[model samples]
Target chain A: MNQDSLAYLPASKLARLLASGELTSVELSRSVLERAEHLNAQVNAFLGWDGEDLMAQAEASDKRRKADKALGFFDGIPVALKNNIAVKGSLLTCGSRMLENFVSPYDATVVERMKAAGMLVWGRLNMDEFAMGSSTETSYFGSTANPWDLTRTPGGSSGGSAAALAAGMSPITLGSDTGGSIRQPAAFCGIYGLKPTYGRVSRYGLVAFASSLDQIGPFGHCVEDVARMMEVLCGVDPKDSSSYPAPVSPFHAELELALTGGRPMVLGLPVEYFKEDGLDPAVRRAMDEVVAYYKGIGWQIKDVSLPNSHLAVPTYYVIATAEASSNLARFDGIRYTHRSESASDAVDVYFKSRGEGFGEEVKRRIILGTFVLSSGYHDAYYLKAQLVRTLIRNDFSKAFGEVDLVLTPTTPSPAFVRGERITDPLQMYLNDIYTICPNLTGLPAISVPCGFASQNLPVGFQLIAPHFEEVRLLTAARAYEKGNDWHTRHPAL
Target chain B: MEHIDIGYTAKLARLELSKDEQELYSAQLGRILEYFHVLSSVDTSGVEPTAHANPLHNVLREDVAVPGFGAGPALANAPQQREDQVLVPRVIE
Candidate 1:
């Protein structure tokens, strides 16, 4: 296969090739790394790259294959991890100056699992500072540009992960989602992104953004690759208390069945998401096309109501910032890197270190979170937001009772220009308007590239399923993906 | 709606904001919090606050200790480290 095609082939196809001895893990790793090195100047997708370590892992996988002791399907697959997810002995900067020099001493649970599966993992992708922003402009490393249009953003928090996948830097990647970090970027970059049901994957190594809302999920170019990743990623870990103890479904097997099944699928279109005002014309057109396509394919499409949808952005900001304030308190200069040079006392050290270490968006969130959780404002803001969260969850539960899955636009619009929304925090927060509700309800949601807009930017169709129903979600997504070519399209660099 | 005192909140957050940052964040946060006022319209009077979406409770593990990263790795990322300990600014002098 040509180098360009080799770089962009799905992990499933790559795995098959590896098994048949058509390609070595070392060759695949080199192709991916070469592409990444060539594109790094313009894309800024990776924050750290360990070529030596990566080649060593690839050699080990090749050796395993030669010995007829291959670990798993992912034995030779190259995978990139969002920086927030720990990989031992690597710099785990969550795109912040606070932990800029910090090196992880232990592997995150997912990293351990991937290592066991024999995946070649080495790159640390850039993200918003502490995964706090929607546009990745907040990253201290620099904003990751959209691969499609170099001037536009790749969407964020998990922006670099999505960009890397879109640029074919890696066949599969892991990203943490809290308030749409994974899905939004996936939508923006026109790839498949899944935010698994909260607690479906262990968060032991994934840094906490919002304890209740955070989840680590996969980003890939196709639904089957994502499902294949789920087979390796899902399972209860004693390390993460919130991880569900339910037995993991055979996702890859279920996906194959879902693709070949003859049953007509029922999908709900929440009426609130399709409102004419403020919705982008191209996105509306894409949704219409997808709904029409599904209807033409003998799928049932019905209108459902998620009445509490409008409150998702506000409620997410309140709860996320509040949790961020508490979670980020561990970053005092004493424990981690990035201590201030001018500090006479402990209190002064904290004030100055945090002040200098965190960027503007991080500070803004810290203050907002602190304000909401402060004694007098807790009940009014924090508690009130939590109650609203229940109402939001109830909306999804009610809709799920009537429909097998709910469908919505992954983002309100296609990827915006680099500096378009960064200046306005409210505008940036609104970017997650359609994506955040899934996190709030802890539903399994996936964003699949459905079509393109006038500017040639990608538009994604989001499918949400009830908790732990990732199989059904991926199956449904695959049914759509098999009939469309959007996921296969790569940006011309 | 109550107006936020940026100075007071910054102090509470342990952030030392400069004059420009305080002004910028003060206006930005004011707009955001003011926007949050919309949540008050929803009647959550009797609703129990949900700390987590899933209902898994008491996820306990055995008391057996697993070997951990030794002190060398534990203190590896510290900005300032002494022998086997992180060195912070003097607490009492």
Candidate 2:
């Protein structure tokens, strides 16, 4: 393969090539850096880059490979970390103006692991401000246009990560999923993204959005690549108290776990999930076909119920906003970050800097969050949402006891045309209905391509597994992908 | 019937949306809050309000200081830096 084809190699493939000496880490890293510089004007997948630093790291990896001393599978692959994952000395903006020039002094636990595993950190990708929005449109940096069609969205706050993968600018990336930020964009951008169980991966150094709901996971071109990256990044980290302490299972080996004859897995469909009036025929058609595909492979199917699910979106917003409001309070001007030039006093600077720095959607949520948690209203709104959240989780637990996994369309319709829904906030929030509830419940869910919709945009079929049951979900997802060429259909870049 | 004041919301949000923007947000938030109000009317006498999914318990970590980034490298990229820490323009009180 030529140097440019190095841009298109998946993480697993890139690793294989590097292992055999057919390609050096220098060739792979340089190929992608040049590609990112050239193609970034089109998709705007990155927020920052380190050309010299990347080359230095790649050369070191090449040395390790030559000496037959190296880290595990990911030793030479070029990957991007979502800006939320701090890499020492890199700008970690999280796509917000508030942190526009803020650079981190330390590596996040995930970044530390990525380096230890021999992966070269290319740069940071753009995102919704603080991982709060469903689309990258909420970014202060600007929206990332879909690679499939520059006129539409690439889904967010991990839109840049997925766009990078889809455009072949980067083969693997790390994205935080608070409320479907990873999967929604991955689906819209036609790549594979996973939201592992809430504690499956460490959250250390991820700028907090909703501490409980936020999880960091990988975005890759294929299921095996996600499994490979997860193996390095998933194990318990003392820095993050919430990371699961159990040994990181043999995820790479688990990927080969087959789907055999006769109900090897149970697939459940929650009828209420796809019941709104504005459902797209293309998405529904894709869902029906996904069901038939699984059935043909001898998997059992049933229509399960999550009765309180209708309340999930509101509940998610309440808890996420409240957590965000508190977590974001530390960014006040006193903290050595963005401050207002016009402030005559400390209080004014804090309020005004934050006021101007945050985007409109962010300001809206902060106000709503403050109102719901203020002295008099907590019992009425926040508490009520908490109670509803319990019912939602219980419903999923019961459904899981009856079936091993469930399938749903990752988004309500398909990727919306850019500038189409930004004017209508409610319509924008509804775009993630199918994916957010899983975040609220902390289940393991993924978006894998199932079919194409229109204008060459791909539709992702989603699968949800019980908390920490990612192996089962990956096995089942690979089964679905193996049956069709969904992952192979890249955008016409 | 009851209602919320947009002026209060703007002050709390620390945003200065114009009269037109307030009017727009008020109407939109009003509809959203109205739906939430309907949710409140439903009974929840026997329900337990869960806070987090991992059976919320106090998770404590050891207080020992492990190695962190060297202060020099840590401060290398701070837009403004001082004595091993970050610096900012004087925030008015």
Candidate 3:
């Protein structure tokens, strides 16, 4: 009931124990707070910690528990929000100088939902600047090390959230995935991360990166906990115009259904994913183990090709950066957090304020976006990427016709040493090679622990489902998790 | 095919790169752009460019007026603020 070993207790059990009087929410909160404080410095996963407020909430939850009130499923649960996610009055820096001190006036739709569910919002975690890089190293705040190995990175832009969950800094952490941000980091850090189908969760209050590609999701050590967090966060929001209006299903309802009673379904292996420098030898072994386990459970496996998947990375960069440039323009000193003191004129201020405020990665992408969208270059760079995007989408639509789910190695390798890929951007880009295509096509994808590499770091197998198919994605993940103890394994802080 | 100047690209990329930073990204981006230029080689003449991965449609909401901009803390942290809005340096062109 103490749940000290974040490695041991599932969230559902914690909820049950706290409800049945075996434990109090305050005690659980303090245990996590103590663990977080002990391990946070090693990983640098959190940017802020509201320890006192969290305890206050826990005490309130305790009061409710003692009074025999109907405690919500996630009541008194301590969770962290990615720095890019707005938490009212919390520094919502999107890992950039642009909003270094920006505070949100209100909660994001996901935050509001979690708040309504009685979950405690603990603090904000680190991320890549404007969610740009494949590793958290791009963060203006500096990088988050993989809790599994301090020398290596927790693959990012959601690296902080993933690492926080891995180190037990929080029970779960919310992350936004734009082209593998969540899952890749989840893979690297040895935790569970999901990118729900585009439009599945409300984007309102999420600091925009690419309005089209970004979807908020959750990271946890286990599949069902991730699903529970997903159920609470996924929904329609009138404020988020781009969110789907479809009724949000109870992620748990179908979750148990998928594990216990769901039919044995086809799992597709895309040939392209395994063709070239596809996966490290050990990771390939991990994939084999995952597939064999699924086959052992009578699930049919097949090979399906997403022919245009090869174009996915380029397509994603152009579309995501183009949207990023537009969405981030609001951060100009005229409107938000920081402005320049040196510029004497309006034009000078426009250039200098942004120049001073944005980090190199943010500037690089903005300029890349500006060039791609400029009149003479528009049709060439931006339009070409968009065309390739169509092909990527078409390929997925075609492949989905053949199978219910597709599996691939999440990252080509386990967490690489921090600063290892700093000099080589393309190599870092390739880190997301297998994961980006899903975001390009608005598919729901989840990364669950498969096995550990030689360095004792974790490797992940990514399962992607057709859009709006969170149920199927979570089902396969839960299925794989139950038969394998990979999901049970946690990083030694 | 158009070639991007190293100087222009560096300026466009807004990097005051140390000689190494400039040289590194230049080589890296050049290779990527060259490979990506294959998109130019593809026949997309009649194909419509897709901006979104999902099907494109409007996500418009009712334009009813709602009160917003709770400026209490927003103004508190401002380097400067006036009348519940952010204050900025002079901007007349």
Candidate 4:
């Protein structure tokens, strides 16, 4: 096996090589580190990388294998994590200055699981400050550029994870999707990203964004790699009370079965989604190709109506910000966050520290949240948004009654240039128009690279399944991915 | 679009804002809230609110004392600490 290409190999193929003694964990770790060293200057995907720590974990994995006590198929693989997900002793920055110097004192539940399985915790990937932006540009550290096109954004707040995996810095990485964070970036970087059903994965140590909508999911070069990640990552955790009390789907097994031949599924196309004004011609073309492919494969495609789909963006922003205002109240200056040296009193610490710590977008959302949840406006904005949220969730439940899955374009368009939409917050928020409903409805959705658009940028189509139906979701994704070469095509970086 | 008092809202949220920030955010928030006005048109009469996404239950555990992270780890990231306590600006004048 050529060591130079080891970092880019699929996790499944890498596992087979490790089992066959064709590759050592140390060799693979070194290769990944070397690739990051070469590409990180351009991609800016990582917030922090510790070569010594990574090698230590890799050495342990190798020693375990040598002693015939290997943990499992993924024992030695390096999986990067979005910085918001805590790893003890690592900086849990969330790409914000508030926690820039704060080190996690304990592992997140997901990190604990990865360590238990002997998978090396690779490093912290960059993200929008506190997972609040559609593009990675909001990150305090710096924006992560698309490996596909250096001038454009790798979609965000999980842009770093997507970019890192797309650049072959890690075989796979995990990201939290509050709205379109994971899927949008995955779409932009031309990889696969899965936003698991809400509560399907624990969020114990994931720094809270919008608690109800935040879900940690995987990004990978192929559908199988993401399924492999789900196999290890999914499960109930007592630490995260919201984690579902459900059996972990044998994702890889189910995906393999689906690929060979799963029952034909009824895929729904939301008429509202297709009819939206901003639907890029290129994105629509990609979705058309996906619909045609699925139809060719004998799957049923039907036009469905999500009458309340137009309200998704408004409802999501209202609810997300209200929750964010409450959730972010924990970041007072006294604790493990940036304290304002200019403060003269306790109250000043709260106000000035936050003012200093948070970026423009975060502060904007916090104020928006505060306004909606304020005493007089609570019923008018916050409660009204929640009531509409029910309508949005009901839209999905109603549609699922007619179809096995819902398919749509993951993003409104291909990756926009770095500064294109940053100045216009509404335009940036609109980017999540198609992606937000799943977060609101608590459904599982995956973004699969459908084809490239103009400028050679990647376009992704999303497949959403009913709550906790990741098996069906991944199976459908595999069905589309089996003969498609989009996921295999890498950026020239 | 409803009028937003940026000064009052920021105070309620306990976030200090610069004069320039207040101006920029006010205009932006006005536009965003105007966009949010669309939700008002949806006649969601008598519809129940969906606060938690998934079906949730109160996770009850035996009322027993359990070992928690000690002061050392808890204070490890504190911006300022003294004798295992996080130090902050004086609360009482």
Candidate 5:
């Protein structure tokens, strides 16, 4: 196969090639690195990657295969990680100046699992500064442009992870989602990204954004590739008490079984989400087509109401910022983060260092968070938001009782122009309007390429399942993929 | 609610905002807070706050002595270090 075909093959296909001795891990890793290097200036997807380190890991996978002790079916595949997830000795900058030069001393639990599964850990993808913004524009390094349209953003704060997969720089990558960080970008970049149910994946060593809302998930070109990743990524982590104490599902096997079964799912369309006001016509059209497609395939479709989902954005901002203020307090210019040279006293260190280290969006959030959690406003804002959050969660629980899964447009629109919304924080926050509800409800949601909008920018539709029901979620997503060629279409690079 | 005091909020956050930032944040935050008033429309009477998505709380692990990251690695990323100690500006002065 030529470079484009080889580079863009799904991880499942690559695994087969490696297992059959038709390809070597070194060759695959080298070509991927070369493609990534060639495209980095245009897409700006990766922060940086060590080619030697990746090749060494790839070689080890090959050695294991040679000894008939290959780790698993996914051995020798390369997986990139968003900058926030740590890998020992690797730069762990969460696209922020605070950790611009900081390196991790230990691997995140997911990283340990990835190594054990023999997946080659590759590039450090870029993201929003402290995962605070919708567009990658807030990243301290630079913004990552959408591969489909260079002038537009790859939705973030996991923009780089989505763009890397779209540009064929990496076959599979991992991203953290707190309020649609993974799903929104995946929608923009036209790839499959799954935000596993909260607590389904461990957060140990993941730079905390909103501890309660954050989840680490996989992104890939196909549903099975993401399912393959889930096989090893799930399960309890001793270090992360929040991780669910559950057995790992045979995701790949489940994918095969799900693909062969008839579509017996009842998909719910949340009426509140389908409002005509803000949703772009193109996105609305794509979602309508997806609903029609499922209906024609003998699947049940019902209109459901999530009356309280409108409060998700406000509730999210309050709760996320409140948590961020507390979570980020550890960065006091004294520990493993940036310290201002102008500090003359101990207290001055915090003010000067944080001001210098954080970006505009990050500061805005920190201030907002602090204000909400501050004296006298706690019950009115932070606590009130949490109580409202319970209502939003109740909305989903009520909807799930009537439907097997919930389906909605992953975003309000396709990839937007890079600078179109950055100046307006509220406008940027709304980009995640459709995707954040699942995060609030702690439900598993997957974004798959539904169709293309105007200008050929890809749009995605999300399918959400009950908590810990990834098997059903991935199965349903794969059912959609099998009937469409959207996942196979690549951006003209 | 009235406009948030940018100076007070930034101070509480231990962040120093420039004059431009203060002005920008004051207007932006004012609009955002105004938007948040929509929450007051909901009847959250007697609703218990959901602090976490999962019900797991106070998860206790066996109190066993295990190896920890040695001081060398622990302080490896500290901005300023002396031997095994992290040096901060003297707080007692």
Candidate 6:
């Protein structure tokens, strides 16, 4: 197969080829790396990669297969990591100038798990600096362009992972979703992204953004690939205290069953999500089509109300930023790589280094976070937001009691122009309007490519399942994916 | 619900903002706080604060002194380091 065809083959197909000896992991890795190199200039999807290390891993995987000791089903597949995830001996920049040269001394648990599964973990994908912004533009490394339209953003902060998959640079990638980081970008790039229940996947190696909200997940060209990734990436990790102590599901097997004999499930459409004033007409039409398609497929569709839905954005910003202010306090220039040279005293060093090291958006968030968490203001802002958060979660809990899944538009619109909302942080924050509640409630949410909008950019149909129900979530997503070809569409790079 | 003192907040946060940033943030943060005023209308008088989404209690692990990254690896990324110690700007003297 030529480079494009080989690079764009779904993970399941590539796994079959590897198992059948029809293709070798080394060849696949080389083809993917070459494609990434060619497209990186235009798409800016990757920050750095070690081609030699990847080839070595690929060769080892091939040897293991030859010896009849293959690690698992994902053996030899080339997967990318978001910049924030720690991969031992690789640069863990988190797309910030603060630690641009920092190399991780130990692998994140997910990286260790992926390595043990024989997957050739290759490259650090770009993201918003410290995973702070909705657009990848906040990255000190630079913004990643949408593959569909270079002038537009590949929604972030996991823009690189989604853009890489959309550009066929890699078949699969992992990203962390605090608030729509994975799903929004996946929607923009027209791929499948899942933010598993908060503790479903280990956050041991993920740089903490909002500790309670952050969960690492996968981006794939298809639902089967995502499910296959979850099979490897999910489960309890002793290193993470918040990790769920539950058995990992046989997601691939479940997906197969879901593809064929799964019973139709009830889907809830929150009327509040559609009533937002700025929602694009094209997105509305695509959602309508998705509802119609599910109805035609014998699934029950019902109108559900997340009455407190309008409060999600405000509550998320308050809580996420408050946690961010606390979580980011470790970058005090005493331990990291971006200490200021002009400091005369310890206090001066702290202020100057943070001010210099952080980007504009990061600084803005730190200030906002600081304000909400400061004395006196804490009760009114932070405490109130937390109480409101419970209300939002309660809304989801009530809806799930009646419906098996909740559906909404992944983003209010398709990828906006790169510089469009950069100046208006509120407008940019609204990009996660429909997505943040799932994180707040700790539900498993997946974004699947539904159809194209008027501008021909991809639109996403989001499905949120109750916590730790990834099997049901992926199964439902698979059911939708099998009947549609939207996931098969790739951006013309 | 008045405008926040961005300078004081930045100081508390250990960040130094420029005049432009301070002025801009002062206005922007004022507007965002105004937006947050909507939360007051919700009757959360009896509601409990959710610190985390999942119900988590004290997660106890066996107290074992597992070997962690020693000083060598731990301080590898330090911007400034002396003999086996991170070199910070002198606060005394």
lDDT of each: 0.90, 0.82, 0.80, 0.91, 0.91, 0.91
DockQ for every model, please. Answer: 0.84, 0.44, 0.43, 0.86, 0.87, 0.84
lDDT by residue (tens digit), candidate 4, A1-493: 4545776688888988888888899999988988899889999999878999999999999999999898988999999999999998888999899888999998999999988888999789999999999889999999999999999999999999999998889998999999989999999999999999999899999999999999999998888889989988899998888998888967899878876776899999999898878989999998888999999999999999999999999999999999999999988888889999999898899999999999999999999999999999999999999999999989999999999999999999999999999999988999999899999989999999999998899999999999888989888988888869998888887
What are the runs in model 6 whose C-alpha is more than 4 Å off?
A: none
In the range B13-74, model 2's lDDT, one tens digit per residue, is 55545577667767777776766675576577799987776643677876888876687765
Residue-level lDDT tens digits of model 5 in A249-298? 79878767876764588999999888748999999999888988888778
**Chain A of candidate 3 compared with the true chain A, TM-score:** 0.97
Q: Write the per-residue lDDT of candidate 6 for residues A121-183, one digit (tens) a residue.
A: 989999999998887999999899999999999999999999998999998999999999999
The per-residue C-alpha lDDT of model 4 at residue A428 equals 92
Measured with DockQ on alpha carbons, how good is candidate 6?
0.84
Native-interface RMSD of candidate 1: 1.0
How would the docking of model 1 be graded?
Answer: high
Listed per model, the TM-scores of chain A against the true chain A are 0.99, 0.98, 0.97, 0.99, 0.99, 0.99
How high a TM-score does candidate 1 get?
A: 0.98
lDDT of 1: 0.90
Could you tell me the TM-score of candidate 5? 0.99
Model 1 per-residue lDDT at B88: 81
Candidate 2: Cα lDDT at B9: 62
Which consecutive 10 residues in model 4 chain A have the weakest lDDT in total? A1-10
DockQ (0 to 1) for model 5: 0.87
Model 3 has a DockQ score of 0.43
* CAPRI tier of model 3: acceptable
Give the TM-score between model 1's chain B and the true chain B: 0.89
TM-score of each: 0.98, 0.95, 0.94, 0.99, 0.99, 0.99
> Lowest-scoring 10 consecutive residues by lDDT in candidate 3 chain A?
A1-10
